[model samples]
Target: MTDATHRRPSRLPTRLLGACLALALLLAHQPARADDALMAGVHAFLYEQAQAHGEDVVIEVRPPSARLPACEAPQPFLTHASQPVLGRVSVGVRCGAEGRQVRYLQAEVGVIGDYPVAAREIAPGTAITADLLETRRGDLSRLPRQAVLDEAEVLGQVARRPLAAGSPLQAHQVQARALVERGQKVTVEAQGPSFRVTREGEALEPGGEGERVRVRFTNRELVTATVIGDARLAVDL
Candidate 1:
């Protein structure tokens, strides 16, 4: 067990000892089963799965109030793959070989880690710099779904709205600083395997890095390209 708590011993009857011995033999002959201790299996599954995002994980699985039938060959799965797996998560368990009987369990996946927060109040349109941000450690799952953990995603970005000091930075509150402006002359590059072409064009719209911009070439032809740098855009051939 990766983690555990000690509990005082309780008296057991002589007949129960024989039953425990038989159960131990059963487990020895079979593969590890989540059904042995339902919550234990769920925690193990979540901890292992959450390891991809962070090393330190704390999980809490809530058992249903109603008694559940013993599960044979229990297989656990995430109920909402598109939704956030942290905080409150729904996990589904398939009981028996055919997986016809399904049950859902609620869980909280708390990953302890440090995330960047605003060191000072940042006004709208302010470009983020390392000096303006500080790190705070806590349960990452308790943070906003769009919280920005990677400093690279925050630095040099323009804030879309005011952020208070010590506030957790989220993805929705920031935007890439505009790299190309309307009516600006831009270098348009179209590239393909083993070939590349560069042409001069005028941007018809303002855009940030990785953003799409419409441009008109000297030939009066229009094309949409992705902004890669200041006054630079690219289109895949």
Candidate 2:
């Protein structure tokens, strides 16, 4: 009745104390309905549905607007850096939300200050198989430099008898086993120690003694020998 009825009852308790302080700051920033931690590992900039693998994202680790450049001989996983970066990182992962109130279940291996990375490379190590995360480039490196049949090199034998391992190289009945160079010489018509040829070439066909004869030399190289008979004519290397 006076002062507009006491300011309409004091504006309804000041709008009910500002609606109870905005509902307690939105329930204290929500997120925690049981907390199983659905997933999180965004080391930095990542969007294609959070690098898809399961995708359900809601990440918020904070503190990496960008940082990717620190792999000098870092050849372990194959790609993380080899040169060319503006902001390097290594944790990266995402996927969470659906039934809980706020979770991020899987994605460990994080450290912007220590460096650990080995939780099975991020979950995986219990007899793991799928070729164990398969990845082969130079695979293990080494054990691939023994196919050097030089000295006129050119071999492809197995012209008339046996030839396994996906055999398929027939040139006029296969016959060109060339290789014998050190001083050069041929003609041994089978027998005992007649040694004298330093080097020669050609005869990449005709197999016997132990089979597998495909030699053709002359700096051409195509060897595959095994037949050490028929008087080899000369073979120093």
Candidate 3:
């Protein structure tokens, strides 16, 4: 074989090897997967915010239907300034060497727990009871800001307004039920570090437990006392 014939056969293999290496390098420099980038961006944003708020929360990030362009660095942010990080919200994913490309996705965050709800229509001033309330597993972040998270919070509390059946109970919508009625006879107890004394008195206002009420003693003296229970008041001597 001549020198030209030997060179020709080796040239084909050399070209083939060079092509394979170029292809590999091209792929290696390419951006990361769109779903993975988006997910990482969103999760990091949400996780940091949740940690800052001291909330033990689970964040579920939904991938965008449209594939995002490859990016060197991805950053996620809220779509709206007032949009809360909790519940159903939209997040914007930005990618670029210095924040050039941008995209958006939807996500949900929830505090996994059982929350209280009204089992029946509750009238204003009606005291909440076990039979009138129910518990449901839900994302606490999706609920209202004042939503009651525990059954104990709503029980024994009176509704401040008309509550629809199946509606979530809120902390601001309930108050402790009145334990002492207006003009009712009550036993006023005066207690201190040294001694305790009990006397008969009349309630001048309706109040719940731990609430302040005025009482008129048999001696025609008015004293401010804290309602302790049904027809009962406690005064510090």
- Which candidate wins on TM-score? 1
Could you give candidate 2's per-residue lDDT for residues 1-237 as a string of tens digits? 555534434455778989998989876544431121211223223323233222332333343233322222211121243311112223322222221222111122211111111122212112222221222222111112221111112133222333222222222323343233323322332233654433345664544344454555678765554545453543334
**Judged by lDDT relative to the true structure, which candidate is superior, 1 or 2?**
1
C-alpha displacement of 180 in model 3, angstroms?
0.7
Q: At residue 85, what lDDT does model 3 achieve?
A: 61
1 or 3, greater by lDDT: 1
Off by over 4 Å in 1: 1-38, 51-56, 64-75, 82-84, 94-103
On TM-score, who's better, 1 or 3? 1
State which candidate has the highest lDDT.
1
> 1 or 2: which has the higher TM-score?
1
Task: Give residue 185's error in model 1 in angstroms.
Answer: 0.9
Residues 51-126 of candidate 3 have per-residue lDDT tens digits of 5333678888887776446655787888876654677878887788778788778888766667778898999989
Q: Which regions of candidate 2 are displaced past 4 Å?
A: 1-9, 22-24, 31-87, 96-219, 222-237
**Model 1 Cα shift for residue 175 (angstroms):** 1.0
Model 2 scores worst on lDDT over the 10 consecutive residues at: 110-119
The per-candidate count of clashes, in order, stands at 0, 46, 0
Candidates arranged by TM-score, highest first: 1, 3, 2
Distance from true location, Cα of 159 in model 3, Å: 1.9
